[model samples]
Each structure stands twice: as structure tokens, then as C-alpha cells.
Target: MFKSGFVSIVGRPNVGKSTLMNYIMGEKLSIVSNKPQTTRNNIQTIKTTDDYQMVFVDTPGIHKPKHKLGEYMVNSAKDSTKDVDLILFLTNPDGELGKGDSFILESLKGKQCPIFLVLNKVDEFTQDKVAETLSKYSKAFEFDEIIPISAIKGKNVDTLLKLMVDKLPEGPKYYPDDMITDVQERFVVSEIVREKALRCLRDEVPHGIAVDIIRMKKNEKGIYHIEADIICEKDSHKGIIIGKNGAVLKKIGETSRYELERFLRTKVMLKLWVKVRKEWRDNNNLLKELGYKNVK
Candidate 1:
């Protein structure tokens, strides 16, 4: 029998939701950073085999909104719980159930599907602490299953996969075997540039920045040429991104070009420019143009 279904991985910021999805998919489909609100979209990563196909939806971390963009991200995370076969609610063993997690659990309490309280980053804690955390959360919401595993270390993750497959319903494959993600090439390319920026910049600049792909084409000699604009919110921030003598922008470009070459499997000629769009995060039209549209 063929089993297939969608599983949403939802959690607070920096709780390893993207890490778990990347580990499960065996590829870097969703970009990762230690910063909050790093993931801005509900990216679907497909894992297909002869027996089963699991669609893992990596959502933005649910948090209180401070702007229209923040509201969209939180709503995007909430919408995933309503329509999935199961929820691998990823969280760290923070010793106690905090407000951020409690809010998410209260919402999941109304959902129909099974929910797995997958405690990630188990390698960072002691066995007793992990056990204590499992016990504490078990009383809060009556989750379907509770397992502790380190996503980065592949510990007990195979068992997690087994439990997920057992819980899935029998259905047909939703995507072709060769396909691994639901996003287009342009979206992934833009994300790659954004990921590099997030890694290089400080706390304030990364969240206010966006990458716009202005041009992407290939030449006859098997080389890909790409051009993008790194959008910031203020003139000073533009200077920060560009840096003195263009050092920081060069760093972002070089790292992005390396990743693009790997993803596209060809030589990459990348061009980057920094531009300011004051408070673009709060601008509704600009938000939609930057691919933060509300499909819900």
C-alpha cells in the first residue's frame, strides 16, 4: 500500500524546525539561521519512496506580530496546522513550557490530526532533563507521541520516521519522484542570497533586508548569470550592507555565488546591488511584491 500525507513542522524561532526538515529531506531546501523569523514562507519539502511519500511543510516560527510582515509570518504558521496529516511540533527542551510554545499548543489542541512533540537538540541536554521535559509536556496537551532526538546528529530520527509513516494514510504520490520542493527556481535563488545576508549581517539588518532577483539567464558556454538587489529599510542600513569599499557586499555575493553554482550545477556570475526602501516591511504592496503574499 502507498501511504502519503502532509506533515507540518511548527515551533518557536530557533527551535530547529528548518534543521529537522533539511535533515529529513537530505538537502538544504529551507534556509536556516539562528535569528527569529528567518523562515518567511511555508516551504514544502517532499520525501518520496516506493512505499510512502511525506510532504514536510517547514513553517515560519510562530510569534507575536509587530508589523504587517510579522503578522503574515505568524498567520502562515497558524494556517499549516489546520490542514495537515500530522504535526511534528519541534521544540527544544527548555525545561518548562514557555508562553511562545504554550500558545502554539493551545491552538494545536483543536486540530484533528495526530501531533508529535518532537523535542529537538537532545544532544545539548542531559538524559534526565530530556526525560523531565517529555514528562512536563505530556501533561499539558496530551500529545499523540513524544520523542527526543537531535536533528543535527540523526539520533532516534529513524524511529521518528517510522512513527510518522505508521500514522500516515494510504494515498497516491502528490509529486514526482525527481521533484523535492514546491518552490520555483527563482524563489530558491532569492532565498540563497537572503541566507548569505542573514549569516553575514548583525541582528538589526538581517530582518529588514530582502533580495530581489532582477535577472537570471544562462550563456552558451554552460554558465549562469544572475543579478539581484539587496533591499534594506534605510540609507544607513544600505551603507552597512554595502560596507566601506564594498567589502560586506562582496562577501555576500561570493558566498551566494558559490551556493548558486552548487544548486545550478554550473559556473555562476553573480552581481549584487544594495538599495533602500524605507519601511518596506510595513508596505503592503511592497511586501506582496517581495513574495510575502497572503494565500490564506
Candidate 2:
């Protein structure tokens, strides 16, 4: 008999949830950065084999909502926990369990599926430290399994996957073997642009930024032509994105184009423009336009 199920990786921000998904999928289906809340959507990644298939949901980190966008992210994260075969509650090994973890656990209070306390970044800790941390978390919650792993280094990740597969029930495959994620090409391209911007900019600029793909088409010459706009909350943020003599914007475009070409496996001509939309995060229409719609 074959086994198949969905697993949600829910946690606080900057805890390697995206990294773990990318590693398991063997592809970059979600964007990653040092910035918290980088993942704004619930991305479903499918891993299929001859015997078993696992659908993994990568969610935004649970946090306090300061705006409509924040509320959307938090809601998206919480909603992912409703129906899943397992929950991989990821947390940084060095950080102590705090209010964010408590809040997320509260949200999962009545979930029927088993919760796995995944301690990521174990490469930085010794065996004794890992044991101590495991013991500390064991008292906080009754996790079905408390597994330590180094997502970046691929340490014991296969074991985690095997454990999940063992717990999955018999079912049919939910997605094709060749398919990795459910996200659209345009959305992934937009995320690539946003990730590049986050890598290039600093301070409050990245937080206020959103990428909109105005147009994307393939020319007869077999090259993809893409035009995008970088939306910001203030004129000063726009200036920072544009940079002195347009150097920063040029770098962002070039870097984004490089990644897009690699991901698409074709030549890409990327055009970018920065626009100031004051208080876009709080604007419901703008949030919906950016695909951060709140749960109704």
C-alpha cells in the first residue's frame, strides 16, 4: 500500500522553514532571506516517490499583525494548521521559546494531527546542548517527536522525512511526480524580484517593498521579456531602491534577471520601475493586489 498526506511547517519567522522546504523539494519553491516574514503565502510543495507522496505546506511565520498585510500573513499561517496529517513546528535552536511559539501552539491547541518539534540549526550546537534543548522543549509541549537538524547542511533531514512518511496514511498521490509546488510562474518570478530587492536594500526599504509583474511574454527569438514595478511605502524608500545614479536598481534588475533566467532556463530581459504608494500595507485594495488578501 502507498502512503500520502499533507504536512504543515508552521513556526516563528527566521527559523529555517523555507530552507527546510527548499532542501526537501530539492528546489527553490519559496523565497528566503534574513528578513522575517519573507514568505507571505502558503506554498504547497509535493514530494512523490513510487511508494509515497508527501505534500508540504510552507507558511508565513506567526507574528503580531501591525497592518492588514501582517494580518493576512498571520491568518494564512494559522489557516494552514487546520487540515494536515502532520505539523512540523520549526524553531531556531539558539532562541528560547517565547510568546510567538506560545501563540502558535495555542492556535494548534485542538489540532488532531501530531506535532513534531523540529529544532533547526543544530550545526551550531554540541550533542549535550542539543539534548538539553530537546529536554527543555519536551516539558513545554508533548511533541510526538523532537528532532534536531541542520537544514543548511542536510543533517538528519532524510530521517525526518522518513519519520513523516512512516506516520502518513495510505492514500493516492495529490500531485504529479514531476510537479514540485502549486505556485504560478508569474508569482514565482515576482518573488524572485522581491528576494533580489531584499538582498540589495537595507533598513526599512525591504519591508515596505512589493513586486508587481506588469508584463511577461516570450518573444519569437525565444527570450522572455518581463516588466515589473517595485512598490514602496514612501518616496524616500523609492529613492533608496533606485539608488544613486540608478546603480542599485540596475543591480536589482540584473540579479533578478539572472535568477529568473536560471529558474526559467531561458534568456530574460527584465525591466523594473520603483513606485511610491504611501501606506500600501494598510490599504486593503493594495494588499489584495499584492496577493496578501485577508481571510474572509
Please give the lDDT score at residue 201 for candidate 1.
90
Q: Per-residue lDDT tens digits of candidate 1, residues 93-181?
A: 86878999989999888788999999999999888888788888998988898989899998999999999999999999999998899
Following a full C-alpha superposition, what root-mean-square deviation does model 1 have from the true structure?
Answer: 1.2
Best by lDDT: 1
lDDT of 2: 0.90
> Model 2, 1-296: lDDT tens per residue?
99999999999988999999999999998999999889988999899999999999999988998888888888988889888899999987664667888788777777899999999989887777777767767887889988899999999999998889889999998888898888899999999999999999986888788999999999999899999999999988988999999999999999999999999999999999999999998888888888876634
TM-score of each: 0.97, 0.97
What are the root-mean-square deviations of the candidates from the true structure over C-alphas?
1.2, 1.3
**Model 1 lDDT, full chain set:** 0.92
User: Looking at candidate 2, what is the lDDT of residue 107?
Assistant: 77
